[model samples]
Target: MSTLSFLLLFLSTFAFIAGGSAAKSWALSDNNWGLLVLTLALYSAGNLIMLRLVRDLGMGVALSLSGFVQLLAVNVVAFFIFGESIAPLHAAGLVLGIVAVALMTYPV
Candidate 1:
């Protein structure tokens, strides 16, 4: 991919994962409604950017790659930033998910 496309994809992925983190952190309804709304808005914006990036690429490749990017980003943030731990099984599951995405998206 070109540098611009790569940058756009990275930005889209970062925004989406960050928004999810915010939503998870502010799960309380009454107190965190504003946060939830903000996160949702960010997510919507990220999705729009992602859609444009995907259009520049292709749906099958873009979505399949994005699925893996989203999964890795969320897990990495959850583990390192949030001080969360995953069991070995979950790690294996993540690997399996990546493999699945690669398989499903491969130009056959």
Candidate 2:
């Protein structure tokens, strides 16, 4: 991938993490309108970046890479930033996800 595509993917991953965090907070709280709004905006931005990624890299590669990145990023944020627990199963799942992404993106 080009430098620009890498940057866009990074930004998109960050947006997914931010949006998921906000959504988690909103769900935990009784009512957090600010978080709700922030989540929506972040998710929208992430989607826009994802569109660009699909355009640049094609749907299969872009979606696979982005989905794995987002999954890992959100899990890390949930565990470290939000003090959520990560069980052994969750760790295994993450490892499997990484492996899957690697296989999917490997050059033919």
Candidate 3:
């Protein structure tokens, strides 16, 4: 994929994950209408970006790459930003995920 498309995908994945986190927070709270709205907007924007990425990279590759990126990025955010612990098993799974993405995305 072109650098522009990759960057857009990265941003889209980030927004999507962040929106999920916000939605989780809202769900755990009594009232947080702002957060709910923010989540909806962010998810919508991310989906739009993902659609553009699909056009550029094809649905299979684009969605796969975005899913992998979102998985890793959300975990990293949870670990560092949310003070969540990463157990050894989780670390191993992350490594495996990276290897899988590498194999899947390697130039044919």
Summarize candidate 2's per-residue lDDT along 1-108 as a digit string, tens digits. 999999999999999888998899999998889999999999999999999999999999999889878877887788799898878997898889889987897889
Query: TM-scores, in order shown?
Result: 0.85, 0.90, 0.82
User: lDDT (CA) for every model shown?
Assistant: 0.83, 0.90, 0.86
For residues 41-91, what per-residue lDDT tens digits would candidate 1 score against the true structure?
879988998888778888877887788788878888988888888799988
* Model 2 misplacement above 4 A: none
lDDT of 1 at 11: 88
* CA RMSD of all predictions: 2.0, 1.3, 1.9
Clashes of 3: 0
Alpha-carbon deviation at 45 in model 2, angstroms: 0.6
Candidate with top TM-score is 2
Which candidate, 1 or 3, would have the higher lDDT against the true structure? 3
Where is model 1 more than 4 Å wrong at Cα?
28-30, 105-108
Per-residue lDDT for 28 in model 1?
43
TM-score of 3: 0.82
Residue-by-residue lDDT tens digits, candidate 3, 2-25 = 999979988899889889888878
